[model samples]
Target: MSEPPRRNDDALTLLAVLTDDASRAQVATITGELGDRLLLATTIEEALAHAAREPIDLALVDVGIDGGAGLALVHHIPALRHDARVVAVAHRADLAHGADALAVGADALHLLPLAGDTVASTLAAARSRRLDARERHALAAALAAAHTTRRLYDRAMSALAAGEVSSAAGLFLEGLVAGGLAEGLALYTALGGAAVRVAAIGSLSAAPEEAAALEALARPGGIDGAYAPLRRDGSLVGALLVSGARATSTSILDLATLIATEYAAQRRARAAMTNIDDVGPALTTEEAFLAANEHEIARARRHCRRLTALVLRGCGESSALAVRRELRSSDLVARLGPDELVLLLPETDTLGAATCRRRLERRLRGLARDEGRGPLLVTSGAATFPHAGDSLAALLRAARARATAGAPYVALDRAVHALPLGELVPTLARGTLAHFPSVAPLDVPFPGLLALAEQLCVEAQRAGLATYLATDHPGRNLRAPARSLSARDARDAAPTPEAGQRDVRPDRRAASAQGSSVELRGVAHLAGCADLLVIVLRGEHASWAASGRLANDRFVGVHTHDPRLADLLAERLEEGHRRRNPESSP
Candidate 1:
């Protein structure tokens, strides 16, 4: 009937150690029971040699190989088959060595006085790790996947632009599967605020009214799964829902969950873009774009003209804030890098995109000249769709091409990506085009916050006061605040950060410390400062510091503890404010 299923080539190939026939029998017995393949080696050197020649997925190291040296000899296992999952063999007295074995990457350690059950389980775990090893066919699959992704991405863009959300979702789901997960895939959508299974596969038992159940689950109560709402600017389009699968590890699940979440955002975006095409009984520009490539859209890659890469630079804090102002929940924009982002503009072609690029460049240049500040470069470029081969790589390659072109920004084509909007946001921000908290925005004079920020920094630098400006996220993830406050004080904190929400300057806050503030990512980049002694508050309330379990402030009688950011917050805020004032005459 059907062709035999491909072996899970990713399966573990086991290597067992032994001297006498008894251990060999145990090895064969365990391997057979585990349904794993085996390779035999009598001595440690022999095992190492065999493993080096081919990929040995797991190693059952005989710690007492020559009837001695338990933990010491196990070190050879890691040296030989470095990536192999190991299970250490030990004498009953060597049971303590099990902990040591595991620390060295041994999946599990088995006692010499082994029970059949313990041996099997350890082998099974090794098998699991082997199968899940992110390195297995990762490189190859990743490479092969690289090709289809661009086409898929273009397809996604096309579908979204044409208002074919369902189709675009299919592209996303399939592309994600190709990206890694062997498991079947599905897509969920936000219908009336609830993330429902708009599409799916591999769903095993009966799902209980998934749409309605999911809607209920999204509310205030009910198991209350954390909703990391996906927001572009500040609009809540839909949430990225993650369901737990007991089959995978937490790390694996989280990564998979995020990937799944991205599909949701892309699908929503595609749907939004496509709708311009479907509005009935009207001669619409959206319909024209859709109609141009009607047959070719179905043909997939053939109809698409050029696939261009857009590289948006100078988008630090100020740039991000400006972009955010332009983006709405209904219009999806995903952050691909700290300062780089991808906007899937559907159907708009390249020639047209170039015109749009020029328009944007003119505006930015005008602003830069008017402000008499730093040069702002946002450039874009195009690589023909199939010619560039339409994937993330293709897009990236296209983007890389334009990077050296001396343009601040570039676009492939306007019509290919930009669906003619009924009405675009009049401008990113209003009244004087002042810089927001993003790195850089329109630099015309406005009510200045930068002056205050500058003053604070001068005061701090003059007094040699260490300052640290607190950020909501982008920087929050960059710097994890040191926790010195107790649980109750943190939990009862009030005056929820309203006034602090108004971002002043662009991304100018930087963490300067003689201390150990520099972390895994590097120095914190934002507006603010910190020192040992500092004052803190929320809105008009003067937050008092806590001393030995005694909180000294009452906020409108709510009695909340000072925020964890208490120490240098006032200075950080003031520094950030000073940076926003154009009149400060930097």
Candidate 2:
């Protein structure tokens, strides 16, 4: 009843219960040839004890043992070891007991004197069956594990899509661990151009150089084991780093991409919500300011009079009161935000608006000095109608762009000398066009300039924007594309030909263009402007300008979305027009 040596899992163990010497020898020979461990049980009790304790793969029972009590042993042996294959052996005359063994739980019945080849084949077959069962069990376990992994991945994705970034990252890290990846995982989000660790799992610490390398991997390039970049709108916004073996696995890479995408989406959603919260309030309330501004703009447009808007930031209640005292009864003063105020000055041109702004600044400064507060800090920006914008929103945008505390306003003349027009135009256009609504002047040949101008003019006209084009060769510029103008004129036929036409008198042309409120002046000659091309566009929502003086066979100037710049340039061009024609209505 002593235990035998431990057997290999692949090798089989056989328990033989027999009374006959011949049957015992035959079983021994078969077990030896099969390379299986064989155990002998002289009594039925001994056989049952072996069955209970041993890892038996095949059990050979002598049906004639214990006065045929071995049949009961056959039934109980299988119950003890469910995986053990039981085969009953009996004499040819004891065929009745063998059949009874079959009726019970014995898998097969064999007769003695058992043939060597027949018993050998039976033992081999039983071993093969045992191997197959083991494989199936392993496969089943693997399938269950795979199912669990899939469930974890699905849950992580669901959480990520729901904006639960922290929960998602944790679940994803858990999934990696469950998949046998015992590694440190760290997720870093890009904040203000630097990698910030937002979510992480395990103890992942790196030196400065190692951290730098991880950040580098987050950029647009190859993904090393150190980190994987999370990109949004083709720009890397975050990185995921891993430490240890299996860090660069396919599952890890795929999860990194998914997590990056979801995290970026989450950030964008938050930013959008923040933007919604930060919207500038209209004087008192946004609605009130908008309503008042709209009414003033419509009245100004109807009467062909100028309207100016001033956005003042950092204007306290005292400064605002001082500002109101200086303003005329017709002028509007509204609280734009907690410390911001907007002024709507009716019938005021840019010069007049500037005069009013200076007066307010002086008054506010005097009040501040009297109150013992030094140098009243207020930023003011001005936008005038037909100059800054045609609509309230456009005017506000223009004024806000020019407003900055402690920053001196760069005049149009000074800005022109600051940088080369070719270099400066493109520099202004750098970044998203949606945020900075400026046209980036293309560096094209001299002939391409005319074509580019024509294209821009056509687009502006199609959008129903008030366009003003001032070129020395006004006739040649728009007349070259006569078909384009002809079609537009057919749709919007006015009695005064077109505003830029050379044959029409300047006064009549200016008056006629007032119907559309568009001023397209074709100055015959002007100092410096002989080679300069200026295109001004003003719309309800947005206004922008593109001006370039011909230099080195290309137009070099400024392209700006700032409505104030557009207004400034438009006024400059109008001044040239007035100088040339002494009778044109100003």
Candidate 3:
């Protein structure tokens, strides 16, 4: 009915060819309901021009135009627009002319001034044909592409089976060639602490940090034309970065998955063997964790004991050891990878897990201090049983998504109510490691957010804390000079972009020395390293879960309405810092 309301951004274009004044008037009466969607062309030349520039869906041609040369136009419509449907019309009903129109590839031949019912039925049939033709063409193209991909994929699989391919990189290159790509291809492999280039065909190169960021985006699923993560057993090991004009095909993604799976199986086989001799009774393997988690989940279901799963990423082996030492003997611990760990906390509720997290944060911070490194930046997320998930894999996925979303802790508690905006700031200080300021439905203005950030930065500096005020706003109209904010001296504070400056660093890591508060823009790479990261969720870019994954400490959320909110936030942060390091109090 009425063209199904035009289907959001997919309005159809109809070209009406009426050479005479009388014909124009009659055509207008039939298509007046379509309004601007109908394009009127007086001549065949004008009709062809419209077809060339716009995607014409349907065309109404009167063969009586240009001394009946319109019959010739009917033959050329297929060349002009293969997808467009044509309805040939005449001033009066002439069976001979209608027969000729039908012979010349016209979908329908109608006589003008006919009954409204006849016109509607004839046009409906033409539109149906147009749609059916489009679907057929699309299906044919997709089938052809799939056939080509399958052929290439089969060859790659054959090579692997025949021992012709040796490395993961080589397999990846084969995938690219299968996808009809020979240039501008790069492959990055996640090697524990960082991402390394595994293979390259063209001059394209992505930095280690860029590769890491790309891998993060690919975890849930690969984005088109960007990168695809190589996952095995539901964990990310590396990613394939696609650049330039070559879009990633489904076959390419499947090939990457196969390669990753092969690699992981080999590694796990070796690890499983070594664990029998090397692993102590205190810690377990991923296989053990799976069995134990399922068993505990069943026990919890029967006895009603609470269970929680915590996943930690980017933490080194030392951190993992420290975590094992701190955990109770009853707790189940397992290694996810070289830099990842999973802990199953039995007989623990969300609140208990949270308290444990805070204590561990303090201990880890102290450990980092002793090691003379920035606080061990660990991105962790926890999910509870029954509420978060019923199975181990589901729970792990939920936690990983929350962790990736930058949420400090995500509870699958379907019953809990979100805190109000007014109390969110305070609750953030007490419970969460990172806070996203609550805003109303009416979005806050950009200037208000900048003002709030400035206030927070000033307070941070006054408290003897190095502050970084990073903004991803496109303009260079910051409060300070628009240049890199690298520290010049140990005690030097993080710099700010000067007003009226033209430089804009879309992704910059601005850090202060001891008690550093690094500011970051769109830099997902620096998020894990920041002692405190302040994110201003403005407009549609607001994604709080992603922000939590970046900050090492709990982030603070502020509102534009409260001018005094920043001062209170800074005071609470300082108080918390002092409480953590009471022995260092001056």
Query: What is every candidate's alpha-carbon RMSD to the true fold?
Result: 22.7, 23.1, 23.3
Q: Candidate 2's residue-wise lDDT over 244-269, tens digit each?
A: 64546665665666665555444544
Off by over 4 Å in 1: 1-11, 33-35, 66-83, 95-99, 131-586
Off by over 4 Å in 3: 1-10, 19-23, 29-32, 41-55, 114-123, 162-195, 199-586
User: Model 2 misses residue 399 by how many Å?
Assistant: 22
Best candidate according to lDDT: 2
Off-target runs (Cα >4 Å) in candidate 2 are 1-6, 179-252, 264-586
lDDT of 3 at 494: 25
Instruction: Give the winner by TM-score.
Output: 2
Write one digit per residue (lDDT tens) for candidate 3, span 1-586. Answer: 0122232233356677765556555545555543325677878888777778867777878777776777766777667787777778777644466568889888887776455565446555656666677789888876776566566566556444322233434645644554455455556545444555555554353323344543454454533335667766776666776656456667666666555444433343334444431123244456655754555565557445456788877667677778777776446667766666777776555434543554565567678779988535666767877678887787788777766764332231111123322233444434342332443222234454445455554443443333343433334344332122223224564245334222222211111112333433433223222233334311111111111111222233323322112223332333434455576453
Per-model TM values vs. the true structure: 0.27, 0.42, 0.34
Cα-based lDDT at residue 125, candidate 2: 89
Error of 2 at 187 (Å): 5.2
Q: Is candidate 1 or candidate 2 better by TM-score?
A: 2
Best-to-worst lDDT order: 2, 3, 1
TM-score of 3: 0.34
